[model samples]
Target: MCDHHHLRSPAPVGIVDHVSSLSENFAELVETEDYADITFIVDGARFRSHKVILAARSEFFRALLYGGMKESQPGTTEIELQDTPSVAFSALLKYIYTGRMNLVEIQEENLLDILSLSHRFGFVELESSISDYLKAILNIRNVCHIYDLANIYSLTSLCNVCKDYMDRHAQEVLTCDSFLSLSQTSMRDLIARDSFCAPEIEIFRAVSNWAEHNKGQDPTPILEVVRLQLMGMHELLHVVRDTGLVSSDAILDAIRIQTESRDMDLKYRGYQVLEENIATTRLGASVIRGEMKTALLDGDTQNYDLDRGFTRHPIDDNSGHGIVIKLGKPYIINTVKLLLWDKDMRSYSYYIEVSMDDKDYERVIDHTGYLCRSWQKLHFPARVVRYVKVVGTHNTVNRVFHLVSFECFFTTRLFHLDRGLVVPTENVATDKNSALVIEGVSRTRNALINGNTHNYDWDSGYTCHQLGSGAICIQLAQPYVLSTMRLLLWDCDDRSYNFYIEVSTDQQKWVLVVDRRQESCKSWQTFAFDPLPVTFIRIVGTHNTANEVFHCVHFESPADTSVGSLINSVATVSVTSGPPNSPRPAQAQQGPAYPLITVDRGPSLSRSSSSSTSSRSESHQSVATATRVHFPQYYGPPPPPPSAQQQQQPLLPQPPPPQGLPSLHLGHYAGHMLQQQDVPEADRMDIH
Candidate 1:
């Protein structure tokens, strides 16, 4: 009786969540727009909001609601916000009352508006929350669009996010659909960055293609951003002869510089690798067509196919029709180099079949569905064959297959397993090759693999939301024996993080290998894991000392033994940070330092002999490449491959074209992803 008494403890008031229930009720009432004290008229859509709640959530709202304005005294009020859109204010109201939002539910086209309006209304916290949401969803297709909005609004935090996205994905961003419409200023900013990862030719092709795509538009204006002087003589002459993309003046200047290579300041020797071309030799051989017209290759070398005026030539639209190039007595072809029309301007579908007898063909590379225009170096394992067949299948515009040049390059390495690997989500920092290290430069994606240790003051590292807990998954083209894993966190020799390394053969069942939870993180460290065969490795995060956010600049692993023991170099990016939470890890307990290496400049890939703890200038440059990456964890299987002879049709109905950019546009896309489906679902499996 004594135990049962005590008046039921006054009904335990703590059992009721006032704020939580209020939030839920507010959210439920959002759409009905019922009992709303204030109606915000945005782009003709009325958003009903409560005055007290709005004032409490935002200073701007407080000023308007109760700061003696006409809106504050209103009995029936409708605030006309023509400059803003409904998608934005709808989200803003929900967030103001509930302090939360589901970014996925918001249409991406409206994300910018939400962010802009957040800033405009002095919802500093909400604005930042929106920015973080954008950062977490960054991708090649949307990064440029997001940047445009971020730049227009001076969202400093978001600007950093865009720069980082471009740092690691410059090539893709430059060739992407959004890139064609990028303002000249945006394009110029990209070209000027030292973090631009691809060769000069990539830029040239993109610019030329953009000009062609928007035919009435003069692409020459964009040429001002092109640094033709950076191209080597061989590369320059080839571009001029093959593409006709460069002007006469630029070509002449490049020619003069190349002709005087002996006296020029540029040294052909000691040239750093830019991770562009694969490490394959262009086996100097002759190619002839089945019709025996020499297949447009008069000299069997680059730019020898036809004059620039020819533009493109398509193979006869018949199943057995193709361009056959005989490689002497069939040396194993490791790589096939195809210089197509600009990647954005045109896309071709083709089958790369190798035949011992020209009649019987075995498909070696079935690029039957992809639409690519830039230099495509396809890597397959060493296959000994006599005839290399380039068969056209389909194209985006149905134009004739435009072939500038097709060359077969051979190497001991057949597998280009890591070519187009992509991080599954924006939660992780995708890898990069080169990164800008200038002080005060915001963090860019280059930090992910820039071969540079992160500097807190410079923010030269990948950062995630303050409260987010996610994994960084690195998808591999083929399974490799795990060797060494390196992580160079932002800010050298300080800071701590709680994380673990995991592996998955099938992105479904993940295995935990390296567990370093609650351990003081290190700057420039390496850990050698026992050899394990795995297709993907995810670095799972627990926490970081910088309680504000979880960040890392570099995450790398050595290429499989097939790439051979490689060399590494190092660069530094500086950032200023308050004192980290705890004592730094003892130097003796830290892993070995990672020296950055820029691969694929030729077999003679070189690196700085010693790891420097010093800073590097704009002169410092490096690039890296990854292939065959994928994560099917929560995502559906990639689109199916096309049949050999089936006229390739659109995989999915082409989405209605994007609406033109909006002023105060929030590029926060929530619609379906505009992915290329580059790596098919079958190929993404363990190669073993």
Candidate 2:
């Protein structure tokens, strides 16, 4: 009453006067509760007045306060409100000033003092903010309390978030006593949900290492955790196979958990699980039968004579060609085993025979022995034979050569070998030069023969021609050191002739390496020559009147020289380093040929003379003297005349004689040894 009129002097009649005037007018307009069409100015914009009024509600105010406070200072503690009674007022003020609620501050125990205020005052935003902030900070140590709170409040998202965080940092948080006390369901849920995210190998290693260290400790908890997380029995077995973590105690604990659980579905799964997890070991068994494909029955009960034993089954009578085993094909036979039942009375022999094209037969294995009273395993190296037949030669009076069991095993995993050389069956044709169409052999005319004459026609289609009492020769384009030679004749047998091999660095100089006459005229056989290096090779047929009608020719490196050189060189070097009494290493030491050297020296020097006079005289002397003294004489064998049967065939066109060219002989001639005339004048250089 004292000067109240002065305080309300026309509402101060300035900017405040206008504001007050507008407020009064708004109050009058809203007095009828008719807020139908009204406008109000807020922060720089005009809005419906009803909207502004609705925004002042407790819920909206709370949201505004929280948003504003978060924007102002992210990740900082929010301001605390007073008592529950003042919470609404605080929320209202925050909404009016910042349009958001700051209820995240309620995470503090002290802030919980006003939690009910937000719930009762219709501040839903503020309530939710409090729950979210709690979830972000909850951990294993406080998880129990948080869980109870979440359950009471029905906060499912918050509960899941807390569980997830605890599981991710389990090693760090599980040390807490409270975490260990979690209900089994809670622990199971946590592990099952998070296991997929765990590093599988690392977890396995850690669990294994932990169980190994704590051998005698109770493993129930660890086992329960793993059982809940393991997806299947196969997964468990894989883990065990790789990590070897599940100890006996751990396995028992897992079994107990499964038994106690009401999950009947896991029973069958568990049985298979344990069976697959058992450790496994491996053993191997094999059989051998030389080149034969037949299995051994029993040699223990009967005495057998291998050479005298022969079994014959005609191709027409052999109904089980499909069942018959093959050597070096479907299976390889290397060793044979025979089971013996009695020793004193049983003696037997075994024999194997193979036929070419089911016609002519050859024996591969022939052995005679008495059966001992023990199971015997025998080894046999593969020989060159095809069709195989096994027979028992002798039988005891009581036991009649009975066989218990038989099996054939192979060691050659890949590739199959035929009876003879494997060559294409078709595509054979004579060349324009009249050379015979040897199915798989290739030759060029650039090779040398007996003399400096390049008149050899490798492509000539001639089958067998009579040379005027001279040797039949063929040459190669490049010189090759051959150790073995095999020839297949078309109409004549290779074994009928006395054959000799001659090689020459220069066609004029020949060295005979093999001089042997055949006693039998077999269809095919290999002739091994002493290993030597030469440019030209000539085959001279000395005996038997049959013309040479070769259809196939093959050359191979010498086994003794080629393989021996490598092993011998190593042996020699080793022997040189040891004492002289050390058995001389059992082999000669050979090495690669000497390397060529280039120099600007003026004149050409003969290698023979220089090497003899050089510091390596001892080494050169042995090689040189051996070459000179051991040289074999070369006399071209008299050629065979055309047989009467060959003359009966119709005559064919004859090919022209092969052309001749100046032969170039470059043997052991080093580049540095050549004279200026040998090389072009433009390429010469002077020594310093």
Best by lDDT: 1
- What would the per-residue lDDT of candidate 1 be over residues 1-688, giving only the tens digit for each residue? 1232233345455675355556676777776677777788877877777788888878888898899988777585778876777777777778887787777888788887788787788888777777888999998888888888787778888986687678667677777998887766666676665445566777778887777777766666677767676676777777644777666777888667756643223211111112222212343344555433343344233443324411233555455566667655434455677655443334466677876556666676765534344455566655545677777766657746655556565444324353332212111222321111111111242344444442332212443322243344554433344556666544323334666778765456877777767455433344556656555666666665433234455666652223333322222221121123323235412432232322332121122212233442223223344212111011122224335442233332222122211001001112211122322343221111
TM-score of 2: 0.19
Residue 295, candidate 2: Cα error in Å is: 51
User: What is candidate 1's TM-score against the reference?
Assistant: 0.35
Residue 92 of model 2 has an lDDT of: 39
TM-score of each: 0.35, 0.19
lDDT of 2 by residue, 1-688 (tens): 1242345646533545444344444444343435533333323333332434444565443453444645224443233333433434434333433344455543454344333444545666766776677776676567655654554455687766776565556555444555444444454455444222344334444445545555665444654555432344455556654555456555545556655653322211010111110111111121232222123322222443432221222222333221122333111243333343232334344444443233344454443332222233333443222234444444433423433333333233232222211121211111211111111111222121111111222222112211223343443322334555443222111113345657664456788875644432222234555555443455554443222222222222222232221111100111122322232222322321122222121111112211111221111111211111110111123224335574343222223211111011110011101122332333222111
lDDT of 2: 0.35
Q: Give me the runs in candidate 2 sitting further than 4 Å from their true place.
A: 1-107, 111-122, 135-144, 177-253, 256-688
Off by over 4 Å in 1: 1-18, 28-35, 65-76, 211-222, 232-251, 259-688
Residue 437 error, candidate 1, Å:
35
